[model samples]
Every structure is written in C-alpha cells, then in structure tokens.
Target: MAEMFSMLGTWNWLVLGLLLMGLELLAPGVFLFWLGLAALLVGLLSFALSLSWQLQILMFALFAVAAVPLWRRVARRNSGASQSNPFLNKRSDALVGRVFTLEKPIVDGAGTVRIDDTIWRVAGPDAPAGSRVRIVRADGASLTVAAD
Candidate 1:
C-alpha cells in the first residue's frame, strides 16, 4: 500500500477522479462528485509541479471539504432568486382575509359560502344569504368568517 501511494502519478489521480465520478452515477448523491473534482484538480496541478503523495492527499482533502460550503453558497443564492408557492397543496389557507358573499344563511353559527365554484362551510355570527363575509381563519375544510 505504501509503495503504491509513493508511486502515485498524474494519471493515477485522474483515473481515481474518473472512477469516483462514475460511482456517483450509481449512488446518486452530490458528494462523490466533489471528491472527484478535487482529485482532478490535483491531477491537473501535478502536470505542472511534482507533488509528494502526502501533499496531494492533503490538497485533495482540502478541496473536497471546501467544495461543500462553496456549493451551498451557490445553491442558496440560486434558491433565493426562485419563486416558491407558499400556498401549494394548502387550498383553504389561501382564502384568509378574502371577502366572499354567503350563499346560504348562517343559523346556529353555521353557514356555507361559494368561492370560485367551491362551496365552503363557514362558522360565524348569523348572517342572511348574499351578505359579504371575510375569511378570518381556516381549519382544514372549515372556515371562520366575520361579516365584512
């Protein structure tokens, strides 16, 4: 093992990099790709300057660890620029504060309202049909409303 490491050359690093990168395809995580990149960088540098096996290993470790935060910073920057839908899969919560006319009269603190073709059950003070009410809270399919 010691002899093999001592005999490490530019081609060895490049091959190791390629092998690691290929393994990334099998185990689909973004980890091995960075180590592969580190190995490739050391291999490229080895062409210009002969590096001891220990120095090459150190450089590879440094590059691999450094890549994590660098990648995260770039990923965070790109993510911040993208628009995310907060209301995705949460249809009822999106209606909070929106005013809609009651389709059925509220008696005994229960009523129904039609909003965009969907009739929603509401709870609030008694109100006659056609009266406007604002959605104050949402709990699952039920809405708490107030006269608008």
Candidate 2:
C-alpha cells in the first residue's frame, strides 16, 4: 500500500477524477459526482502536501460521505424557491375553463377545435361547427368540453 502511494502521483489522481466525472455524464443521478469531486480535491491537496496512501484514502472517503449531505441540504433549501410553473407542461390542462369555437362538428362526443394554429380533439355533447364550448379538463391527449 505504501509502495503504491509512493509510486502514484497527483496527475494520476487528476486523470482518474476527470474520468469519473465524465462517466457521471453517461450515468447521472448524483452518485459518481461526489466521488469524482473527492478524487479531484484529493489530487489538488496532494499537490500542496505530501500524503500517505492511508490519509489519501481517508480524505477521499470523508469527502465522498460528507459533501453529498451538505449539497443535499443546500439543494433542498434552494428547491423551495418558487417552484417551476405548474402549467408549464400541462398544455391541455392550461386550456381548462377557457372557451373556444369548434372548427368541426362534434358527433357522439368527438370533435376538433382550432386554437391558434393547433388542432385539439375534444369530447363533448353533439354540436355543429362554430359552436362555442368551455373546456372542462384534459383526458390524455383529448379535452373534455361542454357547451358554453
């Protein structure tokens, strides 16, 4: 172990650290990130101070274990910052309670409506083209509507 440390250089640690960080891009979820960061920190420290393999390993382990929780705490605190708009991804849901004219006649609870340039399929009572309807909610890709 001592011989291995004697032979290993800070450059090796740096290379290993970079490789691990790169690997995190392929398999991501906050796992490799901490370890890779630990390796890089150890590498930097090694350059400033000569360290035995045991101390190096200890530092790496401490960094790995300690950093993640601290990061998670800060992350948890910051995440509470005005959550992303709830309506951002719910395109259909955003249309609920709004009124629009039908572009096609609804027959047996099926029809289409044009809002802007996009055509949306609607489910509601039978109505002729040009009839106004109010969106109730979204069901999958279709909207549930009622006569306005």
lDDT of 2 by residue, 11-130 (tens): 877887898899999998777877889899999999999997778888888998998898799789877763666676678888999999999999999999997889999999999999
Q: What is the TM-score of each predicted model, taking all chains together? A: 0.56, 0.85
lDDT of each: 0.93, 0.88
Clashing residue pairs in candidate 2 are none
Error of 2 at 73 (Å): 2.6
- Residue 66 in model 1: shift from native, Å? 1.1
Q: What is candidate 1's local distance difference test score?
A: 0.93
Residue pairs in collision within model 1: none
List model 1 lDDT by residue over 119-143, tens digit each.
9999999999999999999999999
Candidate no. 1 TM-score: 0.56
